[model samples]
Target: MTGRIHRTAAGLGPAAPVRAVHLGLGGFHRSHQAWYTAGDPEWGIAAYTFRNTELPRALTEQQGVYTLLVAGEEAEVVGSLSRAHAGADRESWLADLASPDVAVLTLTVTEAAYAVPEPGQDSAVQRVVAGLRARHRSGGAPITVVPCDNVPDNGAVLRSVLRSATRDDRRFAAWVEEQVSVVSTVVDRITPAPTDEDVAAALRATGLRDEAPVRTEPFTEWLLAGDFPAGRPAWERRGARFVPDVGVYQQRKLWFLNGAHSLLAYAGLARGHTTIREAVDDDALAGTVQQWWDTAARHIALDPAEVAEYCRRLRDRFAAPGIRHQLRQIATDGSQKIPARWLPVLRAERAAGRLPGAVVTGLAAWLLHLRGGEVRDPRAAELVESAGSVRRALLALDEEVGADDELVSAVEAELHRT
Candidate 1:
């Protein structure tokens, strides 16, 4: 246990059978889904990462067991991640998907990953389609696809990706129509990008020199809609809720929690704050977050008390100094995140004849953030290279936001606040 100990050598917990396959093997997936799966002894995840090969290599070396650093204190070793592999391990990927034993395939790469794969790039969704197609030829067993990203109707979106990808393959496409049940999920957990202290903390908390420790907040939630046809882990045992519909629940989360987060990430970074704790604790930024929440709360279909409680809890979570959720990390992929988390609020408020001040402010912060040149989006060249292309950049997020002169003016007005 002294130098880079493996899970077997550490004897943390027994690894479960690999009954699940997860794309995007990252900290969020580890802290959230795999953490729940860690509780369910029946299933384990054979997770893969195409982009970050180093992760799979590290996890594989560590025997797919990593410490879950909750609140930067307690380090519980999660062993449900039974196997880790790279996306290029397509043979294994196809085998897992084709096998009737692997019943559920979940993904959380990011909204940017859902875009059509570039030339020679294998997107996560494309890999899923390929796997499912293979499953069809291998005596297709009913499998469930649960999309755990922030995309609205994530399940339907993934389903569309599958359908569009397999349109020429008539037999496989029909098999998909019958065999796949894409489940939409609303997942919440604040898993910051790991810091250098994480490795040291894991070693201190668990007598093991771990490399891939997942540091996350104490708060977590998972609400799902749709059936697990072949079978799935009893995720409910680990506080996961399976509901008839996750539509309203998703909106509440996307508009309120994620929307506020986008605001904080941009505005906080602009204000020279580094982490969520610093940003949320700042009086001015805190007030802006509250305003954004109030604006979104007007549209969320949840009870006022419930929304208030959720916001209260969010403040507590955000204020936890231990969380250390980085504003810059959250700031990445602003183009994708803005459309998902802020566009609805912007459009709704404008249509209601009330301009969303906080939304405008967040947009201004984001545009300025773009011009500051730390942007990590697919459209980085067009949007971030020059400051004069404000309309082009705004249009990239939404046509309405781009076209509305008043909204554009409001954002421009806020941009001058500095």
Candidate 2:
């Protein structure tokens, strides 16, 4: 059968449904959340990119439609998004939030965007508070805010930020605390940035070029533990789990999967591998990742059975032949990722009087990569400016470094040596 593409209001067809709002309008959002919404038109998403008008412009031009190619080990499962739009229409984006049709507010603001204020804040949370306050003043119904960043206490962090910003505004804050629902979530999907060639291939697959095509692995998971303030997608109907606790799930993904991904990102970049598939295919680096996962696994609280299952899924996803997820992309924002991804496990190891060797090595690689000496990922330059001296960075971030000597020495020693 010849592959063909279609454009509709929602992206797939005119009859496709729409609802919901997402903040970070990026490729991963398209492949994962939008793809899920497309599976069931009843849940369409209104999305806005952060500080950039590019995605909104392209998406608008494409008629708010794009292809979702679920590239597997070799094949692809293609779909379309009909309900997505760039925040080029800010009024429209907020209107949906104020409308009865949109209930859930999902975010993919990446780690850095969440770093509004310094160590504590110089009114850092004010912006988020103002945003929410405006939405509240918009006279909209209550809404649930789900943050998909890698922050440990994501919902609490965002809520605190919002509250701190609005603390002076008693009336608005009270309304928010009572009416808004903040949901903590753990999202896993190794969707990579598509290269020029990959974009060409996606277009070739459909015999039509799409300006905003997204490529991702077949695996995806969303674990939530909070109330949907106003309401939410029947995401559970599509395999999204609303668990009583997302802590174990969060740790499992953060410490092992993300930890290992970070390790390989720096280590692999030092070895000159560009994409994740290339890094995993390298036996030495893949072995390092497995070893890191092994060491980090001991700290996670999930059932050993589920932990093993997650590892299998991660391996398959990383091995995805068609997804060219760049190592550099994952390697971005180490300053923010280190605290949430590596520091907690190190603290746990110290508390238990155990040495997390794999995690230590991963940290060492990050330190080395951040020191601006080994890794070739140019983006690392600006991302880890604080890495020049871990001591100052940690102190500045107010991060409790339990294994001070070991951690610092490990990272410093590997700085030039590694």
Candidate 3:
């Protein structure tokens, strides 16, 4: 690799004015949204990392320009971001939110980040609400807030949270109703956290040392539904789809892609596999994934042919070589992910008087993971404490699921088999 090359707007092109502000500046954002935005040089992003100062510090030093390596294909330097800020930088964030020039705000904070706050706690939703409040106070400029997280009805969820946050201020709440648009979006991309070797390979490929390069599979998709009153990027030109309703698409991706990912994270790890590609390559795990997909297809309202094509694409993504999507990484935050990823399908299947073996097996694998030791979840302590009883643990994790004796028994039976 050649000597270190610091990426900056100066090295790429003159920085565009910030027209979009993004929350949760992570690898997925760099690989997916920022890459999409890069298609239109006129639209620049001012992004903030969720909680980490390190990434922001690194990107700020590099002037928000970073390399995006599409594994086994090519590497390109992306320079769509003009500024990087810490999420805690309320002043800067508020200024951007209140700015009439910023027509759009995007978020990639995970599902858990949308959790209703405990008093005085700062959350992603809370931060957005604060920004909106600032905007409401200073001439409300209509803006679209697109939530790109993997949650069903994400737009509705964010709107609810924002409304709740400003309920005490009747004027602000009315301003939100009049001025803000919550856009639901479904984003798909297999972006693995770059390993040391991956970073080394990027340096070798590019002949320049980059501290913040992101590695991702070639496949990517973004489907959005909602209004953008102040105008937004022509993301549709860059493989993004704008639809009247993203519900079906969202459900399809959540159940098929994310649900299967969770299954692989737990079931695959139990089978001594660490990465998605390795797990999908194994016949047994691949079959289990297919079974999960079949179960999910029953509930998701979509054309069978389309769903099949999506499934095929998902399998290809999971099996992509040189992309080490880690099970441990997917396995993190199961408590938050399970609600959207698995529970809905499981409930729907049971309500129809059929047992979902694949879903049960996935849940059983998670329970086994808890017993296996060293879980990296926020609720690890509670999960581990109840690991002895599948029913107890299920209840502790989600009361609705725990209340069902048959489901709990099924999970217990599956646990024994595992």
Return the TM-score for each candidate structure. 0.96, 0.86, 0.95
lDDT of 1 by residue, 1-418 (tens): 2877576667766678889999988999999999998878889899988867888999988988888999846678888888999878999999999989999998988988776554465778678878988888899999999889999888888888778777877988898998899999999999999888999999988888888998998889999999888988989888999998999988988888888888999999999998888998899999999998998888878899999998998888889877888888888888888888988887788889999888888988898898887788877887776445666668777877788888877777787776
- Give the 10-residue window scoring lowest on summed lDDT in candidate 3: 1-10
Order the candidates by TM-score, highest first — what do you get?
1, 3, 2
**Model 1: residues with Cα > 4 Å off, grouped in runs:** 1-3, 12-14, 118-120
lDDT of 3 by residue, 37-154 (tens): 9989889999998678988887777778778889788788888988999877889999999999999999998887877676788888878888898888789999999999998899
Highest TM-score model number:
1
- Per-residue error (Å), model 2, residue 19: 2.9
Residue 291 displacement (Å), model 3: 1.0
RMSD from true fold, candidate 3: 1.8
Q: Kindly report which residue stretches of model 2 are placed more than 4 angstroms away from their true locations once superposed.
A: 1-11, 15-18, 73-89, 115-128, 373-399
What are the clashing pairs of model 3? none
Question: What lDDT does the true structure give each of the candidates?
Answer: 0.86, 0.69, 0.87
Q: Each candidate: how many clashes?
A: 0, 5, 0
Query: Which prediction has more favorable lDDT, 2 or 3?
Result: 3
